[model samples]
Target chain A: MAQMADKGETFPATVENRGGTGRIVLCCEHASNHFPAGWGDLGLSAEQRLAHIAWDPGALALSRRLSASLKAPLVHAPVSRLIYDLNRPPFSAGAMPARSEIHDVPGNATISAQERAARMRAIYLPFHTALHDLLAERMALGLDPVLVTVHSFTPLYFGKRREVEFGVIHDDDPSLARAIVKAAASTGLRTGLNEPYSAGDGVTHTLKLQATPYGLPHAMLEIRNDLIHDDQSVARMAELLTPVLNMGLAEIQRQAKAS
Target chain B: MAQMADKGETFPATVENRGGTGRIVLCCEHASNHFPAGWGDLGLSAEQRLAHIAWDPGALALSRRLSASLKAPLVHAPVSRLIYDLNRPPFSAGAMPARSEIHDVPGNATISAQERAARMRAIYLPFHTALHDLLAERMALGLDPVLVTVHSFTPLYFGKRREVEFGVIHDDDPSLARAIVKAAASTGLRTGLNEPYSAGDGVTHTLKLQATPYGLPHAMLEIRNDLIHDDQSVARMAELLTPVLNMGLAEIQRQAKAS
Candidate 1:
C-alpha cells in the first residue's frame, strides 16, 4: 500500500491463487502494457504502445488460464515492461531500456539516477522481493516450488519468421526443461529447447535470479505470440500445455526422490 | 572497514583533500584499473586490462593535481570501472557493462541479480553516497560546492581518430560549462562544447544526479587520453585547466550573486 503511494498509482505486481497447493509458481513478467496514470504512454504512438515491445501480447490471458488449470500461484507485473521489466535485474540496461527494437522510448532516454532509483524501489524491487518471499514461504511449508515463467514472443523478429512455436528455456540446471521438452512429444506441437531466445541472450534472468540460486527445478515457457492472440487460442494452448507441465513436474519429483 | 571484509578487499571509494577549503568538489569516477583481490581480471587479456575501457588513463592524476591546485576535495573510485561504472545509475546497463567497444567482458555477461546488487552495494552506492554526503556537508558549512567530474577519452574510437582535445559537457543547465568554454578561449587548446560525447551519450549522469536537483553549477571535463597519459603531461594539463576552472567559478559566483 505504501508502494502505491510512493509512485502515484502503480501496483508492482499481483498474485492470484496464492493458496493453491501446486508446486508450480507461475510468473508473467511482461503481462501488461498498461501505463500508469502519471507516465503518459512513454512518448509512444498508439500502435507502438500496443506493440510487443511494450509488453508480450496475450501473455497474461494465457498465464491466467495456466494458473487455473495447474492450480498454481501466478505472480504477474501489472505495468508495462517499458516502465520496469520485472524479469531483468535493476542493474541491467534492459530493465529500463531506452529503446526496444525500432521504437525509441523518449521518456527513458535521459532518466536521472534519482528517478531510476525511485522506479526500482516502487516497481522492480517490490515485484522480485515479493516473489522471493513467496518462494521462501512455500519452501518453509515443505512445498518445493517450481519456477515456471510464461511469456509470448513475437512470431517475427527483425522481420524474420520464428519457426519454433513453443520454447522451453532453462539456465544452469536443465532437468525441468528437458522433462518439459520430452513431454511435448505426445502433443505433436513444435517445441524447441531455448529457441527464439536463450540463456545467453539474457532472457533467463528470472530463472537465474530466483530459481537457480535455490537449485529449484525451473523452466521458462515462451509461446509464439501469433498462436495465442485470441481467447479461443489462449484457452486451447493452455489446455495443451497443462498435461505437458504436469508430466514434467511429475518427472522432476520422481528424479528428486531418486537422487 | 566492514565493506572491505564484506567484498573481500575492495575499497568502495576514497576521499582525498577531504578538508580542503574550496567551493569546488572534484570527482574521478574511473580512477583506477586495480581489480580487487577476488575479481580476477574480469576474463580479459593483459592488453585489454590496461586499455581505456578498463579505466580512464590519467584522469585520477589530473583530478588530484586539480584538487591540490584549487584547494578542492576529491572523491574517487579505487577499483576499475570494468567492475562497476560509478557515474551510471545501477539500473543502466553501462553500470556493469557486459561489453565495451570491441572487448567482451566474460565476467559481466551472465551476472545474476544478486551479484549485481552486491556490486552496487559494494561499489556504486558507496561512491555516490560519499560524494552526496560531502556536498551536503559543504552546503551546511556555507560552502557552495560546484560539482566538477574529471574524465579522459581514447584518442581513437572504433578505428576513427577524434579531433577534439578538450570537451566541456553539460546537461539541463549550461551556464558553468559555457563559462569554462569561454575561459578556454584564452588558452590555445582546441575545445568543443559537448563534443566527443554529450548528454545524449548518457555521459552527464553525475552532473544530472548530483547537481541538477539542487541547482548546483556543474561541468564534466573530458580530455583526450593521449594528452594526459603521463605525469608531466597530467601536471601541465592541470595547470592550464586550473585557471580556466577558477575563472569559470568566479564568473558563476558573480552570476549567482547578481541573481
Candidate 2:
C-alpha cells in the first residue's frame, strides 16, 4: 500500500488493498491532507486552513485504522481536495471550483478545454476505474462487499454552527444507515440522518455511481471535525463506530439471505 | 448556439443543446483541435505536425455541417484529443496518451491526481452529459434517434496505406452497418467493412456507453482524412453519406417495427 506514493509519481493514480476476508470496501475520497510543495499556503490563516473546505482532515487516519482493523481494501485519493474534489460528479457545476469560499483558485481559472481533458484522463478516471474494478473482482469472486465511505464535516459552515456529531447518509440502501443510526442511538450519541446533506438531490459520485448502480448496501459516515481533531479522538471514534459497522454488515447479510 | 460561445467564456464548460426534432443525434468526440500555448512545437516537422495525431483534423467541421444539414443536434468536446481522447473509455490505457507517434507529450508525463480529476470534470463529463441529455430529451419527446458518430481517421498509420475511402463500424447493430454497406456499394465507392479498426475491439466511448445501453441503433462513420481534407471534400463526403445514413436509419426503423 505504501508503494502508492511511488507509483503515483509515475502512474496517474493507485488503488491499494490490504489483505482481508470481510466483504466491506472502504474508501476515503479526500484522504490526502497535504498540499503540493511550493503552493506556499493557500493564502489563509492556520485556523482557517484546517477547516473542511480545505480538506477532509482526520478521516484518512480513521479510515486507515479501520481498514487495518477490519483487514479490508482501502481506496484513497492522494491529492489535496482543493485541486479537485472526487466526490463531486465530473459534470457537476462545482467540479472545478474557480472560487471556493473567500479564496480564489488561481490555477483553475481560464483553463483551456485541452487542459481540462488532460486532468480528467489522469486523475478522475483512474480512481473510479479502480473502484469499479475492485467491486467487479470481488463480486466475481462471489463476495457481496458493502461499501463504506469515510468523511469528515466541519463544525461550522458559513458562520453557522452545526450541532450534529455524526451523520448516516444513504441514497438507496437504508439497511446500513438504519443499523448505524440504531447503534449510535444505543451508544447515547446523537446521530443525524443526512443532516449535512441529503442524498435525495441526485447529486452523487463514487457510492452512487459505483455502488448504487449495483444495488449494493453502502453508507457515507460523516464525523464532525471537532470529534476527530486528534489521534486519540480519531482512535476513539473508530472504536466507537466499529461495532456499528460490524452490526450493519451482519444485518445486511441477514437481509440479503432473507430476501 | 451562438449564445453558447459568448456565455461559455464567462461560464466556461457549461453544456446546453440546440433544441431539435430529428431522430438522429450526431456526436463528435474529438471535435476540438487545440494545443496549449507554447508546447515547444511538439518536435515534429510541418507535414507530420499537420497529421491526424494532432487532432481528428476535419471531424468537427463535417459534424457541424451534418448537424446543420440534417437538423440534428451535435454534441462535441471542445478540448484537443491530446489532452484526453474523448472517444476512449475514461479508464482505458490510452485515455491519456503519453506519447503519440514519435512526438513526446512532455506535459502528460507526471500529472497529479488533483489535476487529473479537474480535467475529467472540466471536459470529459460535460461532453458525455451533453450527449446523454440530448438523447434523454429525444426519448422524452418520443423520438427514437439513431446515434451517428462522425470521425475522421488518418489515410495511413505506421507505413501502410489504407485503400478504403470510408468505413462503417458497428458492433451489436449489424443491421445498420449492413444497410450502410449495401447503400455505399450501390454508390460504387470502395468501402471498408470495419476497416482501419474493428468494433469488436479498440472501439468504445459515449456512443457505445450511451447508445448501446438503450438498444438504440448506432454506427460510427470513419472517413479517411485524405478524403475530407478540404471544405469541398467534407461537403462531398457529407452529401454521399446522407443517403447511406438515411438508408441505415430506415432499416433500423424496419427492425424496430418487426421487433
Candidate 3:
C-alpha cells in the first residue's frame, strides 16, 4: 500500500515507514495543498490556494518531527482538503464545501452527486481504509496504539483573531487530550481544550471514525498556522512539541498501569 | 425532483405533495428497507432483511399519516438505510454498514471505494439533495418550517429491553425537543429525551447537518417499533403524535415570541 506514492497511483494518501511497528501512529491529514490533476485550481486564485483554506502550512513539518521523535509510523493525506477534506465526514456540506471563509469554491459549488461520489472513491475511502488497516494490524498483534492526527488553523477567522495557540481536539474520548493539554501547559504554551473546534464542528472525523469505535486513545492536535509558517519556525515548533507529546503519552501509560 | 417517484426514475426516494405550502416539513430518512438492485440483500437472510435492522417497520406509514394530518410535505428515502444511510454523513461506517446489530453485513463488509461512490451518486446524494432542495425552496418563500423526522427503534437491543416508548432527539438545539417532551408528559406515554440514541450515537446527522445549519427548529421522533408494528397501532400512534407535535410547535412559537 505504501506504493501509493507512485506518481500514477490514484490513492490520495501516503504512508511513511509503512512497516514501522510503533505504539503511536502520527498522521498529518492536511499535510499538503497539492491540487489534483483534473480539478483545476478549485476555482480559486493562486493566492487563495496558498491560504489556510487549502492546507495547514506547517502541519507536515511538525508531523515529520514528531514521527522521528516518537519513532512512530506517519501517514499523510497529500491532497488539499479543499478537494477532499480528510477530516470531514463524506457527503457532508463541508466535505466538498462550496465556500470556505470568504472565498467560494466554484468547482465544488454545483457538482452532481455522481461527481462527488467519484472524488470519494478516488480519494477518501482509500485514504481512511489505509489508516484503518494499519491500526488494525497493530491491534491484531495485541498492541495498544495511540493515534494523534496533526492539523493547523488560521490565527484569524472571518474577521476575529483566534487566541488559542495549541488546540487539543478530541471526540467522545477525552483522556488522551486531557493528558496532552496538561503536559503542554507545563511547557509554557497557550493551549485550549476543545477550543477553536471540537467534534461538534464537523472536525474529529478521523478520530471518531477510526479511533473511538476501536476504543483506542486518540486526540487531534491543531497548531496555529502562523506558528509554523516557515522552515525554521516549523522545526522550532516541532522541537517544543515532540517532547511534550512523548511526556503526555508516558503519563497516559502510567495512569493506565496504575488503574 | 417531485418526479423522483416516477416508475422510470432510478432515484429511490419519494416525495408527497412536494409543493405543499405548510409551515412544517416532514422527512422520513429511513422510510423503506427495500434492498437495492445490485447490492443484493446486503448479505442478510430473508428474515433479517424483513426485520428491524432493515428499516423501522412502522415509520413510513406513520409519516404518511402525519404528512396528511399536518398538511405538510413529506419526503422519504425508499431504499434501505443499509444502502447509504441517508441519515448518516456518507463515509461513516454506518452509512454503508458492514454490520447491523448482531448480524454482520457480509455484502458491505468488503466493497471498493469506487463501488461505494457509485452507490452514493445513484442513491445517497440525490435523496438528500431532494430533501435539501425542498426545504430550501420553502425558506426561499420566507416560510418558517419546523421539521420532525420520523423513525422507530427496536424495543430490544443486545438482549436488553429499552423501556422508553418514544425518543425525542436533537443536536445542539434543545428548544424543540424540550417542547415535545413537555407536551408528551400529558399523554401518559414513556418518552426519553435523547433516549435509545442521541447526537453522540451519530444518529442526528439530518438534524445537525440539514436542520441545525439553517437554524430550523427540528426534532427526531423515535418510537418503539413494537408499539406501532401493525396498521391499527400505526394509526393510533399517529393519532397520539400528530396533535402532540402541533402542541409542541405552538409551544415553541409561544416561547420564541415571549423571548
Name model 1 segments beyond 4 Å from true: A1-259, B1-10
Off by over 4 Å in 3: A1-259, B1-12
Query: Interface RMSD (C-alpha) of each candidate?
Result: 14.5, 12.6, 12.3
The two-chain DockQ for each candidate, comma-separated, is: 0.02, 0.03, 0.03
Q: Which number leads on lDDT?
A: 1
Model 3 pairs in collision: none
Error of model 2, residue A145, in angstroms: 1.5
Q: CA lDDT of each candidate?
A: 0.83, 0.67, 0.79
Q: What's the TM-score of every candidate structure?
A: 0.51, 0.52, 0.53
Q: How far is candidate 2 from the true structure (C-alpha RMSD, Å)?
A: 15.4
Model 3 docking tier (incorrect/acceptable/medium/high)? incorrect
Kindly list the per-residue Cα lDDT of model 3 for residues A67-149, writing each as its tens digit.
87778889999688888787775546677788999888887887665555556655766677677656755653446778999
Candidate 3 lDDT over B29-96, as tens digits, reads 88887885666676688899888888888999999998988888998987887776878654566877
Per-residue lDDT of candidate 2, residues B215-253 (tens digit): 577888888888788899888878888777777778778
Candidate 2 per-residue C-alpha lDDT over A1-259 given as tens digits, one digit per residue, 9 for 90 to 100: 0012222331134455544777889988878745544233445456645666667888888987788777778888866665556676444435546666666666555444434333444456667666765664564344677888889887877778888889889866688888878778766666988767767643346676667645578889888888888999999988888877888788777877999
Where is the poorest 10-residue window by lDDT in model 1 chain B?
B1-10
TM-scores for chain B, in order? 0.95, 0.86, 0.94
